[model samples]
Target: MSENRQIAQEIIEAVGGKDNIVSAAHCATRLRMMVKDKEKIDLQKVENIDKVKGAFFNSGQFQIILGTGTVNRIYDEVRQLGVTGTTKAEHAKEAAKSGNAFQRAVRSFGDVFVPIIPVLVATGLFMGLRGLVMQEKILASFGLTPDHISENFILFTQVLTDTAFIFLPALIAWSTFRVFGGTSVIGLVLGLMLVSPALPNAWAVAGGDAQPIMFLGFIPVLGYQGSVLPAFIAGVIGAKLEQKIRKRVPETLDLILTPFLTLLVMIILALFVIGPVFHTVEELILAGTVAVLELPFGLSGLFIGFVHQIIVITGVHHIFNLLEIQLLEKFGSNPFNAIITCAIAAQGGAALAVGLKTKSKKLKALALPSSLSAFLGITEPAIFGVNLRYVKPFIMGLIGGAAGGFAASIFGLKATGMAITVIPGTLLYLNGQILLYLFVNLIAIGVAFALTWTFGYTENLKQQIENDSKAA
Candidate 1:
C-alpha cells in the first residue's frame, strides 16, 4: 500500500476496522460510511485521525466528513482497502485491535449523539403538534387537562424524550465496546451501572449536608444518567480487564468465566472510580453554566441568539447542539436553549412578511403557508420554500432572528418543557420572563415584516411600474 493507503487503512482500523464496516461511499464533502451496526463504529478513532473534522450520522448513513480536501483521498483509500461493501467474512481475518481509552471515548460521543438526531426531530415535532392541539382546543374537547389520559400521554412522551439522554452513558457504553472489538453486551452492563437507581445519589446530600453520596470510597457519579464520558471511560477499563481475564482463562471455560468476572470488576470500578470522576466533572460544568448565564443578558443573547439562525443555515448548528444537550443534561434546564426557538420564529416571520408583501403570486403563495408552519415551530416549509429561495427573506429572517434571540436572552427565558413553538416552549420561563420571550418572538416577527416590505416588496413594485410604462 502507498503512504496514503496506509493512512487510509489506519483510518478504517480506527473506525472499528474493516470487519466492522458494512458499506461505504462519498459525496462531495462527506464519506457516507455505514456499519453493520452503529454500535460497532469507533467514533473517537475516526475523529482523532488527521484531517478528520467531525462525524455524525443521519438517516441510516454514518457520515464521515473530512475537514476539507481530504474526503476524496480518504474515499479512494477506503475503496482500495475493500471496505466498500465488503462482506463480514471477507474482513473477519483482518480485524484490528480494540482501541484505547481515547478511541473509545470518541466512539462513545458519536454513538450517543448521532442516533438520537432522528429522535430529537420527532420529539420536537411531536411537542410542536402538542402545542397546536392545545392552542386549537383540539385536546380540550377530550377533557385532557392534567387528567389521567393527559398525564399518561405526557409521561410517556417525556420518558421517551428523556430516555436517550438519561441513559446516554449506557448507550455510549454499548457503542464503545463495539468500537473496542468486543461484544456491545459487555458495555451495556457498565452503562446500566452508570444510570442504575440503586447507585448512590450524586446530586443528593445525606444528613443536613451539601455533599453528594459516596459509593465505597468513590464519590457517586451523579450525571452519568445523561452522560457519555463516564461510561466511555468505564468501557475502556472494562475492555482492558476483559482482555486480561480472557488471556488467563482456559479456552473451554473462557466464554462464561471471562464475561462473568469482567462485568463484576468493571462495575465495581465504575461505581468506585470512573463514575465519581465523571460526576465531579458534571458538577463543575453545571456550575460553569450558571456562571456564564450571569453575564449581561442582552449582550449574551444578542450574540448567540441572533446568530443562531445563521449558524443553522450554514449547517454548523450541530456544534451548538453538542453544547446545548450537555448543558440540558447537567443543568436540568438551559437558558440558552431558546436560540433554536428564536431561529424558528425568525424564519417564520421572514416568510410571513414575504407572503404579505410580495406581488408575485407564486412567491406569496409559497411563503404564506410555510410561514404559518414556521410560526407553529416547523421551519422546514419556510426554510425550503421561502427563505432559501429568496435571498432577502433569509437575510431579513437572520436580522429578526438575532433580535429575537437577544430579547429572549436579555429576559433569561427558558423552556419549561421540551417543545418546538415559542409560546408553549416558554412555559418554563413564564414566571416574569415569559414576557421577554414573547417580546423577542414579536420583535422577530415585526422586523422580518418591515425589512421584507421595505426591500423585496418595493423592489418588486418598482420593476412592475417600469414594465407597465414600457408596455404603454
Candidate 2:
C-alpha cells in the first residue's frame, strides 16, 4: 500500500504537481479532481499506484477511485495542493446551459444525491428486511404482529423507514453545505427547522379545513418534512449570502450576527418561496407515479422497473418509501413491490455471472455468497463487490430487472405483504396470481443469470482481465 501511494504521488507530480490541480472532492469511493490540464495527467502511472481501485476521465473531471477510507486520505492530499476550480454553482450553470433533458436531469440529481447512496442502501436494507419479517409472520409466533396493524413489528418497521426519510433534509443539507463551502452547522440548523415538530402547522387542508401558516406578512412556511429540496435550495442561497456577509461583517460580530441573520432570512425565504414551490413539484411527481401505475400492468411494470435502476443509481430509491407506506395505508397493497424485488434479484444474478467469469480466485469466492445474498433480497454485497467492480454486471442487472418488471406488470402480480426476501415477497402477489408471479419472477432471474453468464463469463472477460494484469 505504501509503495502504491508513492507511485500515486509520482503520477500526481507528473500531472503538473500541485499547480495543475484546480479543485478536488470525493464521493464514497472516488477522488474527483478538476485539473488545469487533463493532457498532463499520467493515467498509466496512476493505474499502477497501489490501492488504486479504478480510474476514469469523464464529465470534464479526472476521477481516482480508492474504495473506502483511501478516498478521504487522498482527498486531504489533493487539498494540500491549494488549486482552485469551478464551484458546484458553476457546474450547475454549465449543466443548465447544455439544455439536454436526460443529461441535465441526471446531472442535477447526481450532483445533489449520488454521494449518499451507500448510507441510503444500508438504511434501506434494514427497513426492507424488517418489513419482510412482519409480513411473513416470522415473528408472529413471538407476538411480533400480535395486534395485526398495531403490532410491534409494524411499529418498528415504521420507525426504520421514517428515520431514513425524516432525516433526509439534514443529510442533504450537510452535503449541500459541503458543496457550497458553508458552515455545516448552519445547514444542520436549517435542516432541524424543516423537520422540527415544534414548528407551526405547515400543511394545507381542504375547503373549510385548516391550512399552512403564513410567515410574517405574506410568505407561507410550508412543511418540508422528509424532503431534500427545501434545505438544499436554502443552503445554496445561504452559502452565497454567507460569503457576502462574512466579507462585510466584522470578525467579532460575524460569530454572533452573521449566522443568526443568515438563518433568519434563509428560513423565511425557504418557508414562503422555495419550500412551497418544490412541494408542489414533488406532488406532481407523486401524481405522475400514480398515473403511470394506473396503466396496464405490463406498461406500469416496465416503467417502474426502468425507473428502479435510475432511482438506485441516484440513491434516492428511499424516496419511494412514502409511496409504499401510503399504498399500504390507503389500499392495503403496494403497486411497486415487484420492481423492488426484481431489481435486487437482478443484482445477485449479475454477481453470480461475474463469479463464474473472473479468473481471480478471491473475487470468485466473494461473488458466490454475494450472489446468494442478492437472491435472498440483500443486494449490497453483490452491488458493491461484484456488479459495480465490473461495469457489465451492473448493466446486466438492469436488463434483467427490466425484464422481470415487465413480466410482473403483464401478470398484474401484487404482493399481499411487504417483504424483502424472495419467498416472503411472494405473499404480496397472493391474490390468486401466485403462480403467475412466481413464473414471471423465475423468468426474470433466469434471463438475468443467463445473460450475465453469456456476456460476463465469456473468454473476452478473461482476456480483458489478463490484459489488465499484463499492463499492470
Candidate 3:
C-alpha cells in the first residue's frame, strides 16, 4: 500500500474504526474529524502512527497534525476508506455547536475577520517597505534624498499603504454581513456610506481640520474611515434588517424594495445612531488597550505574553483580532504583534530543545517540524504536538515569552502588521525596528531553549515514547 493509504488505514483503526468517525476534513496542517465516541479511540496509538506528528481534541474536534502537503494526501486516502468527507466550513459549523455562547460569539468574530487578515497583512508589508525606502540613511546610500522622490511615487505608495485602512469599515461590514447572512453587496454599500465623501472625514475631524455635521443641531456625524465597532455593529444590524425586510416584502418587489429599504433604513440608523454611539465605544476600547500596554515596567506585556498561549489552548484567541484591528486603526502600528510574536517564538524554542534532547526518534521527528511551523507563525502543531504534550517545556516557553515581552515593552517595539509572526514576522519590523525585533525573538527562543534543555526533558519521557512506539 502507498504510505498515505497505509497511514490512513491505521488512523481509521486507531480512532475506533470507520464506525466512530462521523465526518472528516482537513486544514493546512491537520486532519480534523468529528467522531461518534471519543472514549473508544486509542489516543496513544494514533500518536505513535508514523508520519502523524500529533493528535489532540480541540473545540470538539479531533485534530491530527500530518504536516502540510501530507495532510491533503492522507485526507484523500481517509475518504477512500469509506469515511465521510466534509468541507472545512461544514466541519467548523459542527464544531461550533459544541461551544458555549461566549465561545460561539468569539468564533463568529473569527469568522468575520479571518477573511480580512490577508489584506491587512499586505498593507502592513507595504507600510514597512515604504518606511524602508523613505529612510534618509538608506536613501542617501542610493543617492536619493526625500525631496528627490517624485510626488506621484509618494501618492502611489500612499494608495498601497492607506487604501485598506481607509475602507476598513467596508471590508469589515462586507465580511460581517456575509457571516450574519445578509446581502453582502448591500453591506458594502452601507459601509461605503459610513465613509461617504459628503460627510466630514473622521481623521480630519480628530485633527481639528474639519467639523462633524450636526443633525438636529445636536447629534454629530462624520465619516467612519479607520473605524471598527461602528462598521461591525452596522453590518450586524443591517444584515438582520435585510433578512427581516426580505421576508416581509412582496415576492414581486422583493429584489428592489428589500435592498432599497434595507439600505435606506441602515444608512439613517448607521449615521445617526450606530456611528455616533459605537465610535465612542471603540475609542474607549482603544484608550483602554493603550493604557494596559503602557503599564509600568512592562508588567502588562509580561502578564499578557505569559498567559497568551494558555488562552490559545482554550481556542478564544481570535478575540485579539478586534483589539489588533483597533490598534492598527488608531495608532498605525501594532505593539501587540511584537509582544505576541515573542510568545509564539518561545513555543518553537521549547519544542526545538525537546526535539534535540529526546532520544526517541518518533518524538524528534514530530518536534522538529512542529517547531519549524511555530517559527513560521503557526503554533498549533508545536503547542499541541510538542511543547504542551511535555508540560515542563510549555511552562518554560511561557517564561521565555514573558521575558521577551518585557524586553519588547522596554524597547517600545511595534510591528507594521498582524496575523504573521516569528520568522515570517520579520517582514513587519523592516522599518528600522528589525534589530530590536530580532533581539526580542532571540531572548524568547534562547531562554526557552536553555530552560527546556536544562529541566524539561527527562529519561522517563523518552522511555515512555519508545514503549508507545513499540506498542504501535
The most accurate candidate by TM-score is 3
Residue 297 displacement (Å), model 2: 2.6
Instruction: Write model 3 residue lDDT over 1-472, tens digit each, in one string.
Output: 8988999999999999999999999998899999989998898889888888779987789999888899999999999999999999889888888768998888888888999999999999998898889889999999999999999999999999889999999999999899888989999999999888999999999999999999899999999999988999999999999999999999999989999999999999999999999998988988998999999998977988899899998889998988998888788899999999999999999999999998878888889988899899988888888888768899999999999988998899989878889889898888899999999999999999999998887777777667876777
After superposition of all CA atoms, the RMSD between model 2 and the true structure is 7.2
Q: Distance from true position, residue 14, model 1, in Å?
A: 36
Can you give the lDDT of residue 431 in candidate 1?
Answer: 35
Model 3 whole-model lDDT (C-alpha atoms): 0.90
**How many residue pairs clash in model 1?**
6
- Identify the runs in model 1 with alpha carbons over 4 angstroms from their true place: 1-111, 114-168, 171-186, 205-228, 232-288, 314-316, 319-331, 359-362, 388-390, 423-436, 456-472
lDDT of 1 by residue, 1-472 (tens): 6766766886788667788777776654567666667787766556444445346544345666452356778877888888774433233212222245444333345444555555544544444444444442444677655343466777776775566676767777776676555667888877877777765443344232345455555454343566645776787677777888888999999989988998888877877777767756756765665666566746666666566766554443544445555666655456666756886788888888777766655556556776776787666557655675456777787777778777776766765334346655654454345567777788878887678677744676536533533442
Comparing 2 and 3 by TM-score, which wins?
A: 3
| Candidate 2: 10-residue stretch with minimal lDDT | 201-210
Q: Report lDDT (Cα) of residue 399, candidate 3.
A: 95
Give the per-residue Cα lDDT of candidate 3 at 162. 89
User: How do the residues 1-472 of candidate 2 rate in per-residue lDDT, one tens digit apiece?
Assistant: 4544554465467565777876666666666676778888877556545555446565556666565676767666555445443445564454344435665544544555656544554444554455455454455666655355566656676675556566667777766675667788887788777767655433323222445666566655545655655777887788777778888999989998888887888877777788878767656666776687778747777667656755664444555654553343234456677766777777777888777777865556667777776777766557655676567777778788888888877766655344444555654554455577667667667777888888755677667655655665
Candidate 1 collision pairs: 43-107, 44-106, 44-107, 166-225, 306-402, 416-428
Model 1: C-alpha RMSD to truth?
A: 12.2
Question: What local lDDT score does residue 413 receive in model 2, on the 0 to 100 scale?
Answer: 62
